[model samples]
Target: MFKFLGYLFLMGYILIPASMAQNHVFVEAESFDNKGGWVIDQQSFAVMQSSYLMAHGMGEPVSDASTTVQFPKAGTYQMWVRTKDWAPYPKGPGQFQMSIDGKPLPTVYGASGNDEWKWYKGERITVKQLQVKLAIQDLTGFNGRCDAILFTESTDFTPPNTLDELTAFRKKQLKLSDQPMEAGHFDLVVVGGGIAGTTAAISGSRLGLKVALIQNRPVLGGNNSSEVRVHLMGDIDKNHYPKLGRIVRELDNGDPGNGNPNAKEYGDARKIAIVKAEKNISLFLNTHVYRLEKQQDIITAVIGRDIATNQEIRFTGSFFSDCTGDGTLGYLAGADFRMGRESQAETGESLASTKADDFTLGTSNLWASTPRDSVSTFPRLPWALQFSDEYHIDEPQSDWQWETGFGNYNTITQAEQIRDHNLRAIYGNWSYLKNNKAEKYAKHKLAWVAYIGGKRESRRILGDHILNQMDVQEGKFYKDGTVTATWTIDLHFPDKKNSQYFEGQEFFAGTKHIRVAPYTIPYRCLYSRNIQNLFMAGRNISTTHVAFGSTRVMRTCGMMGEVVGMAAYVAKKHNTTPRGVYQDYLSDLLVLVKDEPTPQP
Candidate 1:
């Protein structure tokens, strides 16, 4: 048959036969056209569902990555890899080692095994050359990771070890593209470029819509960006959205200290020059999304991926918004959320916990330190986490409670073991303040830390109003109010002396706050009751969990992303859905949340 369809289209295979398949090959370690210094970590796409390539090298040993692979029907394969032994001790401090057309193998592979992401294997090569290379050496510059490289030549095939069957066996053995790559059509997509998705993509591109603004971190301030430095707390222009936070004061990085190394204050090129000066916005940035496509209850698109060209784009929208803060494209479009703490008789809230629980709150990784004029050495971590002395904390910085996972963990399936237990509580409290507070941090050092985990709670989604804590302590005035929230219920916890030294795993943190009286919020707690067009501003809106401690700050989630980008520009000028802008365009979402006259001219 035309020479077996030209050797199955030159071995990239379609339905087998490049001399009959050979079971698996896969590859993709950032398609390594020489990824030497490694480091592509697309922050655990909802927990190791993709984007990897690590070898971080923080403790030093880097530069090796390599890549090339080709072989179609070679002889003895077996490889394996996928990685993550990230400190499973017995000898695991993120080790590495592998190579192939460049020799070196003796199975070093990551290091024992404990942080829960398997695969490993190795050795058994013999390809008889059809293009080879491979590489990836790193023996502890600390991070390690890898995520992809299968090989196999049937020793019972193997592969698929869950994460939805290894993301559908890497989308059908890396043939990928189940139709994605579009990334355009908009009208208002806005999936987290944070400050409540870049003020809902600059208020749905100044009410004209056609937005997009994805942002899987390249910065646009989710956790006030400067890579999670957080600082843009409450109050902004006042309730019922007074010109809804004037696009969050045109992207404020105004620096109020949250990881300041002599304060450059996260301007992030003035929020990417105000979302590239919004000509009907488009943004994207590192992309991410994961997948979505719904129909019965809306959602229609959302694919993403591009963590440095892993391609797959697909956006499409006519009003979407999940401002990701873990609502992750509204939990991949099945929506209907709510996680942790609810029952004081089911959200009469008053500091909940009379039943419903999973505890919520507790993420921060924040750090900073400076002083250097001389002496600075630090490096005796022994795979961290061992603090003593009444739970030591001699801080040089980090105010956001250097937090860790939380009571029952599972912050989106234990976000990389809660950002590696806040990097082993900031390198075991800066190596116990450089071996017992060297004359009060002698020369300080450790400049900045946030390995991005500023998160504060997850999944709220369920909307059409969930707002609780007695509707912000009885202020309640709904008419679809739309963001004012101010911050006071605060929350957090796990710091009873670091929860008596890591019991249930604590990493500092403590807060209760309570204060009150600022209110407003509503727009039915920002869209989606059954995913009928998602929407939702930061801290995953729809509140509860003590009204997401006063609508989880970031300028009250940037005025609920300027009232869901003015109700997704009145749901694309009335084709409708975000609860049809409060049931048939409630006075055009109250004149786009009274950006001018909710009263007082």
Candidate 2:
């Protein structure tokens, strides 16, 4: 029996022999030894069951990703590849090929006209050697993706197609234990590595709580990370609890400008350094928390799966924080939550919709282009979103405005589709500029494009008090008000001009700003109402859609995290719950919120 070696970071491999009892070999595309220019895409992992490798070279073919595979014996094998035609309307532009050793496969994958992911059969090949190299060669730089490859001597064996079956199959194949390995107990567990989650973990750690900070992505900051490139917004350190944003200030180097082409401006390393400096905090990167272990209504542990290896780890904690932006953790724990807009009558907020509908703020997949020394050429894609001179965006760079999914799509389940729609818009617009308006953009080339969608709104975990627009606009201060929100009620809508062309699937966005005086959000808005021990920060906080417009910004959300952390400290000290901190220990919490020592890096 040949045991699988743990993942090798330098080689990006988890070597295992194919001679095992299963007889079939499964290779995850994301586990390629040399990824070359391919990227790991985990955005649709929950829906798709696995993180795949994508070639996001912006219409240019990326370098091939290669790995070594060991076969049990030299024999003919049937191969199947899990993939899909991303744009299968006419023909997929994201076409790619596979190579065994050095010879390319006859079947061109990703253009099979299959919209849903399925196993596409490839030509059976004779394995001449026990060890051979496998490679993925991209033909189009558009977003060709591969989930996993299967090789089996039994021709009748087929991989599972359904989500539940596929998940179980993968677990069995990977030898993942049904019982997750322990990730240690913590006083507080903060899920998500965004600004709010980072601050929450740091604040809790500094306040004498052992903390675990879990982030799904490789880097922190979420939208502010180089991957999404959104600048920090909202004012900090000017609230009733002035010391609440101390950790935020220490982490905010400066604005990198939304969708900046230069990655250095985002300060990914700086954020990592700050989180690592906290001794009481344990940081888990590329770990996505999906399952919750609960007793009654309170979450006792969270199960996180490593995005790369599919290894599951259980984190037990006395207190839990839902900073996943999408309220993923809260949802798993059966926390009461809200989504989309609320009716004006429901919240008594003037900015809310007259009648409730699912018209929430859209998600953005920002892109940027830079001028090159030499002229650049782009292929006209018939399958991409068709854009005419009157319909296309003329800008060289996309900011927060290059958004989609305002009222049409579910921001969570349809996230992958939303991102693809944005990609089609971007590529189509760029194609028009390069082919039709050649003189203007002759030297311009696509520099950067975010594959990870910068989401605005999702499930808002219900809390003790749901803040509304009137609370901010009327400057009504509650006695329990803690985090101060200072940004305008900037609600985004589908741009009318773009909507006229694309109808229900608008790719551009516009916003109306309802200016408001700086207002403090009540402490009751920070913790789950039904799920007793649950706390929330970031865009998932309890608020009407109108109030969320002001509180969703990074700086404002970070302050909410700081407040949650302080409240957690008081709760831990007194052996009380999050609401208990507000009810019985409000004074103790306020002292910490108002005079907590500034975080040092």
Candidate 3:
């Protein structure tokens, strides 16, 4: 028996390495020690000698570096890590990277562990050849190490033989599909069109790329477009949030990103100005990305379905980013995400419920009108789902009846139906004058149902950290934080009519005063927990629902877009990923935003 145990232990160290996709062993160094490559985090390093796993420290270096590894074979694989620190050193919980033969592995971070040398193992790593090099780094600047490894053989894993492989890997990891996208072989692909997408694509194109923007709408400005009909709302670079929404400034009438425009009836001339300014970025309007295509975890292409043409398209890129307000691209692509409110118990907000989930406040199709010559008698909405006599208004000038079909059907589809419904509702509501038989209801016709609808109240992409109301109320300042949200938790509850669509028993959305100053939005919220090379913007960033309600505002979302854009730029410059910016290259990101608040709008 003793001899058998010895043989097994020796086999653990000597058996030929399998070509599996797993991170059993990781590098403990930053740069490549040999072969111009480094291995980072796999799974857990089996704590053979202790009860706990190895750990790294913040601002502390683990210098016991080993790069050259005697591997038996090679293949595609992902590194899994069970790492932690003594109360995440204010800055973070870093990651362990794996680089083999000059190829780097996607380092997944945001794990919690303790002081013991716990056992961690890598997923099945796929190896193709023998004897490759590896290196690792403490991404959070924390002190830690990797131990055990699985090193199994994997089939789904695609080996990174070339840069095309890298791009393909990233695209697959980001959930970008096989469909062709407008941005082909571009240096950068800005995912969301709305204002951010447009600006980012233009900016990146200017910086040089076949910049392509994947906008889900026929036109741009997403919620502010003629499709949704919701008015443009938000203030630019004011005192509190401090007008940092540069995208708004450059567009939106060049108003410095702070003007509150009720309507851009001038055919979004300002928006058109910005769009026409860029000759580089090809706008893929009416395009929707369903999946990501890539090898390993790096993004390569965004698979999309064009609404107008109803054709599948693929947009490949050197670097891909998401600016979609709902973050649909990132979510379907295997990015880490979260939803709903963090109960008051979790986030310590007075309005938060006690439970947590992936729920969020929905969009609103707003209507704008001025007082007409006379009052139009409203029809008795007999077929109206929530219409009632008690709901009748006497001197109704501005009515918020958008609560009609909310939560009735799918939200993604709701935009299409409700947009038309709102118009019909307006005309039909006005038609009540002919039916009500009241003189007060004279010849007042419908004005407008807004050009866009307010979409996505609280969609949070689960990141390394969840920005909660407490973080805002407490004015939490984080060294690892990249952006900030300055709005209040403005949630809207379901009307008393239909309770089915309501996410929680308690609905929230009402904040008039800006009680809190600027709250730091963490860096972790920008990327995914599982897939690497993916970045997020808009309301889908990781945050409590209540916090999301506040940050989901247009101006704030735009800032998030700019931050992610700048971060991507930084990552590209550094030849790393989004997570890389938060770890070792944070200063580079902050330097971009360090300028004075310059909202040109």
Which lDDT tens digits does candidate 3 get at residues 365-452? 4543344776554433332222224332233233333533324433443343443334333333444543553555455433434424
The best candidate in terms of TM-score: 2
Q: Flag the better candidate by TM-score, 1 or 2.
A: 2
Off by over 4 Å in 2: 1-13, 16-21, 598-601
The clash count of every prediction, one per candidate, is 3, 0, 132
TM for every model, in the order presented, reads 0.38, 0.96, 0.60
Tens digit of lDDT per residue, candidate 2, span 510-540? 9988888889999999999998899999999
Model 3 TM-score? 0.60
Worst 10 residues of 1 by lDDT: 12-21
lDDT of 1: 0.74
User: What's the candidate order when arranged by decreasing TM-score?
Assistant: 2, 3, 1
| TM-score-best of 1 and 3 | 3
Best by lDDT: 2
Instruction: State the local distance difference test value for candidate 3.
Output: 0.51
Global fold similarity of model 1 (TM-score): 0.38
Per-residue error at 228 for model 3, in Å? 3.1
lDDT of 1 by residue, 49-112 (tens): 6777777555566799776676775688888887877666455677878888788888887777
- In angstroms, the error of model 1 at 244 is 25
